[model samples]
Target chain A: MSLAEVAKNPAGTGQKLKLQHLGMVYGQDAESVPVLEDINLDVSDGEFVCIVGPSGCGKSTLLNVMAGFLPATAGTVTIDGEVVTGPDPRRILVFQERGVFPWLTVEGNIGFGLSKLTREERRQRIAHYVQAVRLQGFEHVYPSDLSGGMKQRLQVARALAVNPDILYLDEPFGALDFVTRVIMRGELHRIWQTERRTILFVTHDIDEAVQLADRVVVLSSRPARIQDILTIDIPHPRNISSPRYLQLRDDFFFWRNPVAGRDSSGPSSQQQPCWRYGISPFSGRPPRSFRRRLA
Target chain B: MKLPARFRPVLFIVLLLVGWQVAIDRHPAQILPGPIAVASGIVDLLRHGILFKYIVASLFRVTWGFSLAALLGIPLGLMLGWFQRGEMAFYPLIQIFRPISPLAWIPIAILWFGVGDSAAIFLIFVGCFFPMLLIAMTAVRNIPSIYINAGRNFGLSSSEFVTRVLYPAVIPQLLVGLRITLGIAWLVVVAAEMISVNSGLGFLIVDARNAGNRYDLVVAGMVIIGIIGLLLDLAMRSLENVKSFHWSSSEE
Candidate 1:
């Protein structure tokens, strides 16, 4: 989805957000540093767009700009024909950290931003999303009691309950263990299939990008610019270890290992799509340290 | 396996009281109050209701002053820390003011706000504000950018982003900051009352000292302060425990 498409109609179906040439910079005066550059992006009505990139890439920056938490140093970001200067209830962000209010239970967290609906309507919406996320028994549970995967699921349910125009996720599964991550991936896809609301996902996981996005927008390393845009045609249940998947993954990581055999104190261009790639499943043998994490 | 871990502390308190009673038996009643004398003094104060009155007065001061500080401090701290440019503008001032002791502000507070309730209250606010703000800002600053990013994906507006998204995410640290501020508030309460207050527990001790430093009343007053502090701390602790569990299930 491009800003041009979003602007032409202004009100585009369930489509609620649009960004054009959004760029972000931190600091002021002499030390001002650019974080995102020349970012042209869009979310078609109910389309799930996953942004994948190398480490330190501006993926999160792009999402923050869309959410209106950070204003783009240049370029325009419009949502439903309105320009964004700050956060709105329309676009909600689901962070990796527990975003649930400590004082509010799972049910309350899901109901956090629901001022638009009547209390009864809000409760019904909460109930629906709670059931949708498989958190029926734990609705009264405090965020502290849930496991990592369960917490993320609750966040998803919470965001869904509010019924925002778009849902933004920043590596929501990046911190989970491999098993939990796999489980979250499945749960996420299931939720997305039902809601079909526009989702702008930022992840360092190539497989996660490939699995979730209709089109994966790969970003470059720091001062991140768009590197490549790959359209993944494979449907759900795509195998990551399959030849085509591996080949795409290889290309996603630049198709050549900068440090295949060479070892150096420097970065060695060995940077993976995400932190997990340090284990390099392509090596055929999991490094001893990586094996310890499995244990 | 069922033995109480707290048994030793209870035993220790009992033995210390017994030793006090025994010493008082050997010493003069007027000079050294036995455990019984202090217990009776406590009951007498309760019966007279001065103890309860002082408790209310002190609780009011602590709650209001600390609340005022928290209201202003937390938001300002979060703003300074969340935005890089704001941090650059405000951090130097925070660093400079953070180390100044709250008690040191007593003279200035009296001069600015006058001696009665305002002086005492200003001291309490200052006592808690700097430290609470400092910790809150640090917490906000250290929050990974990922949390803010998550707020955007949900289509949350700026206000919601801060209050709904960013606020809850930094809550674990906010609780830590609250713990620190509560302690600071308690510390300031007595010292703040000491300057001019005529009715708090601090005044009780000072008035007792003026009446020839009557050990029994002095000891009684100190005990009252300690007990109330302990109870308040316990309340804050339980609040945190309940909140921590709630936070886990919702946001984790």
Candidate 2:
């Protein structure tokens, strides 16, 4: 459905976001290389889409281009059929690194860029996000004092406060501990249910992708191109222990595992490496690889 | 950070002072005035009101020069740090000029500005500018690219990126540079003052030396400089404490 079907005409009803034949390239000279290619996706007015891939794949690049943070070497991202030219308050991207304004407290961070609202209006919004993110009573504390999890939570509150039509979260929980990541994933789902907004998330964790996304799109290694898009028929508040959950999680791993077409994914110790796009994990040394078996 | 609990330099200082007192009294040399004699001369200078006037004049000169250097150096350093063109073009020239001693510039400063506070301050500026500028530029460049990209991804313009992200990221390093430069300024001020200034701590020491080797006045001036440098560093530390918005200790 288009954004026009879900909401009133000007507000965009049916389709909230559409990426048509998207491709991205970086570097100016002979080094120029495509990061994402031949990407076509349509997210409904209020759907959760997660893109998972090997670490070096261009998942983040695709989202960055959609947010208008990077130039798309080919194709276009449109909202309500209008092409994205630059970052708008309508589309806010929250990153994994916990990009909180150190100078601002929990409240101030949420209220930043909320220039259109009055002081009272902003206070109400700040208060709302504070509660939403379970960051209550941290209003006066500067970002420096918060733990890693709290800082990421603050980023979430800040992005949500702007009432972005579609939120872009680039591995928002990647930096957190396993426990915190699970908790935040749950909280994020709760927020989506309450707010009912479209969200595009990027993560290398197959379990995380399976847990959060209504549909999971897996991408190939460097010069990332979409490999497959799996619609998750599993119900909300998914149970990882359930047979269905385990199967969906296995499907993601099976494709990403270079040796999945063979019997074993690989030697238990040598799981497929997921290289993040754009960044050279190590210029000279070997690629950064996490070999822990997912299945 | 406060000194380590194991640090008890005061006992060592007292022992040194006692040793000085013993050496001077036992030898009784005219050229090497004893600690008591130096202490007496310091009292005498203070009583006569000369010490206060000289210290104030020296402070006036140093403050002007150091502050002026910071005003010029910080901006230049920030530019060098932030702008690729400026860094590539000016860094080599700055590196070459940086190694020259402040005294080398003193003679030129006197020729250009004449023998007064202006020339002395110019010499001090020369002493402080390079290190402060280099440090500031380094701080600007050292900010992790993650922070810069965060700003860019948010659609911050170039100026916004610098003002909001770059400057804040560089503050801790810049403050450290400020502390080092201030100490250098104090050292340069005293030496610069000794060359031509008629009324300052440097002159007082030289003037006293001219009249029968008044070691007391020289020792007193040196002690005063030490005290001032200590206080300025303390001030910078406090400023750092207040400005630190993120607690780094938690991470490392």
Candidate 3:
């Protein structure tokens, strides 16, 4: 919906975030390179939305614009019917790199944004989040001392402590190992279940998008526009081994790589190196032929 | 089978002393004092109390000059680094002035302060200020944008942003700069005292040379300066052990 439509029917529409006709271009005139174009999206209160695209497809740029770190060349991002002119504490962005402040201890990082709160309130909130993220013992330890997963959890705890209305996660687990990434995703889902904050996550991993998001918004290669939006009809605590899950996962794969879906020459045609096609083949169940080879 | 790390330095120092004594044994004591002569010369100065007085005088100049430079340069550099326009305007000017030796400023310092502690202190300040400023500026520039963005997203006001983000972020690098700049200040104070002051270690060396050729006292002064410089560096290095600064280094 457009900003005017949202504004006119503010009480009826429960959109926590509305992006209308968003466009972004770097530089000016002859040097200008377009990144995102003619994009529109609406996210309801407490909705979990994920944006998935190929690498270097302006996914980060889109998140930056939404977080108000960068100005869109031609759009208005309205949250709760108010225009987003700059960053606000109510909307926090968690970076892919361990964005936890290395200088501050775990408790210190969680308490960083709570400077305006009274001492007792701040202490209670920090303690609550410390336990929430399962970092009970390491409160006084710095980020450098923590393992990669712990550091990412600390970043999440720091964001959650502020009680923000929305959390923008820009490929937050992209730096983690395979096992750690899966563990972090489960941890994030648990947090989301308890916290109920609107989360707009961006990632290149399609499996991550399907596993976490209520609705997955797929974007095409740059001058990024919304190619399709798929709503996962499955319930929470989704069974990865379920036939429905496999169907949806394969559908997303084929949507991403149409040629591979069409050319059904007994897995040989699809045996090309994944990186050349920008496909992540290791995510869920590998192909039957690959599984047989491995066995 | 191997010597402990702690004893290696002591062994090296003993070898150095032995090498020095052997090199100087053939020369007349008047031409070059041996280690024993230099040690005796130090004891003699201490007995007369001039050694303590001269050391204090040199340290006093360095303390005043280096403190003044740090007090003024750090804030100015932070401001310039945060505001790109200010950096663009002033950085080239700083680059032009930074290359000229602090010794070259000796004449101007003397002309302004007129051959005393003030002149020496001014030269030391000149030597230390540019380095501190450059270090602070580069430190601010090197801060990851992620930190700054996170700080702003928390709705920090301008002053809060500086105090909560900029200051803490630059501290690790600033400590390194302060250590190096203080070393420069120490070096500059001695040179400044040689030409413009009457009561510092540099004066003691020059006076010993000119009056009755006390080569023992000259070597004694040199040894004292080296020892004091090492102590100063050790003191500066201890700042890195503070808990807040530990994140910059790999070790816990």
Candidate 4:
């Protein structure tokens, strides 16, 4: 269904978050730079949506606008038919870097939003989340003592502790190594499955987007607008080497760079996909061999 | 060949004492007392009980002055940092007054407080206040916006934000500031005592010099001051090793 059709019905019907004609501009008038333009999207309850675009394409800006950290220059964001005027605890934005409080222990970070609960209740809640995130043994350890993946998990645990209806993640695993990033993706998927919270994740890695998101929203470069929205029909725990996965991944590449896709489809395509050669399609530069072939 | 790191400081001190003894071997004790003469003078003051009284007087002034500055300056700084208009309005005044040495305030302090513990304390207060204020202000300004956003997203009330987020975020930086400002307070107290109060270590130095050229006692007062300053710094440095503050230093 179209986004406009989804917005016509208020969020209480089925939609978790509704954005209509969302636009963001930094500065005023003549000197103003438009960062995001004419963005319309709707996420259903318990759905996972990933936004992917080139670097500096204002994907983070869109997430920030939705999270109510920045007011949209135009249009509105509504959750469950309520207009989001400012940041609310019900919708938590997990930042890109290690957002877990450095000064707080793992337990303390999880219990941060639970100040209203009684002491015993808070302790139990903290313990529950610590176990949920597999940080049980490191309850008293601070974020600095944690590895990159552990810190991100702590951040996710902190967000989950508040029982937010929606979680907005901005390139959360962008800093992790390749192995850790894959591991964190699986961990996040497992947590989301159990928690069933609506997640809007923004990333540049198409592989990550396909692996984690139910619907991937592609954005143009600066002054970002939706380029395409592809739905992944595959089930959870998808085998990366499966033909369906490869087809979808290659389709995403071709959609982004049709000319390059056509060039690679010549006799050289019989070899192997560039991804198998450890080349990143999202890196904005093709492999040397591919470049040589094109030349 | 290579000394252990812990003993290096001790070795340096021993060499310093040897150099001092050699430099002063040909001079009369009245001209410049050697370390041995200063040691005897310290023992003599200890026997007379005057050294204890002087040290206590100096410490009492510093405690009052530094405590008052911290209590008042920290909150003021947090407010100024949190509120942009307040900072823009008052920061210029702080900058203008900061460069004036605490010693320069001596005459005015004496006039206001009438040449006693109060005058010495007032000068120390002036010495310590600005550094604390600036440090607290800078600490508040430097807190990562992510932390503030996180705190607000969790629906922290204004008071809760200050108590939980702002206060804890500023602590590691503030502790370092406090240590430096405390050193400044110590230095100002001695100077203030020399001119106004007649009952501190600073007074002992001036008094010893004037009364029959007791150079040994003057050197002894200097030694005591140095030792006390070192101890105060060591105490403050220990606070930095606290587990909660380990996040501020990346080495952890």
**Winning candidate number (DockQ):** 3
| TM-score of every candidate's chain A | 0.81, 0.83, 0.85, 0.85
User: Per-model C-alpha lDDT, please?
Assistant: 0.75, 0.78, 0.85, 0.86
iRMS values for every prediction: 4.9, 3.0, 1.8, 1.6
Candidate 1 structure quality by residue, lDDT tens digits, A1-295: 4423432433456555666777778899899888788877655676777887766777887887787777789998887778988876667788875565555688877886675679899889889988999999998887767888888898888777767778889899988998999888888988887886788889887778877776677676667776555655555667777876765554454333222422223233533344335424545434676344333
Q: What TM-score does candidate 4 get on C-alpha atoms?
A: 0.90
**For candidate 2, what TM-score does chain B get against the true chain B?**
0.91
lDDT tens per residue, model 4, A200-263: 9998887999899878887877788886677776777888999988767766664433323344
Displacement of residue A212 (Cα, Å) in model 4 is 0.6
RMSD of 4: 5.1
In order, what fnat does every candidate score?
0.55, 0.23, 0.68, 0.60
> What's the true lDDT of residue A260 in model 1?
42
Say which prediction, candidate 1 or candidate 3, comes out ahead on lDDT.
3
Which residue pairs in candidate 3 have backbone atoms (N, alpha carbon, C) closer than 3 angstroms, thus clashing?
A: none
Worst lDDT 10-window in candidate 4 chain A: A266-275
RMSD for each of the candidates: 7.7, 6.2, 5.2, 5.1
Considering lDDT, where higher is better, how would the candidates rank from best to worst? 4, 3, 2, 1
Clashing pairs in 4: none
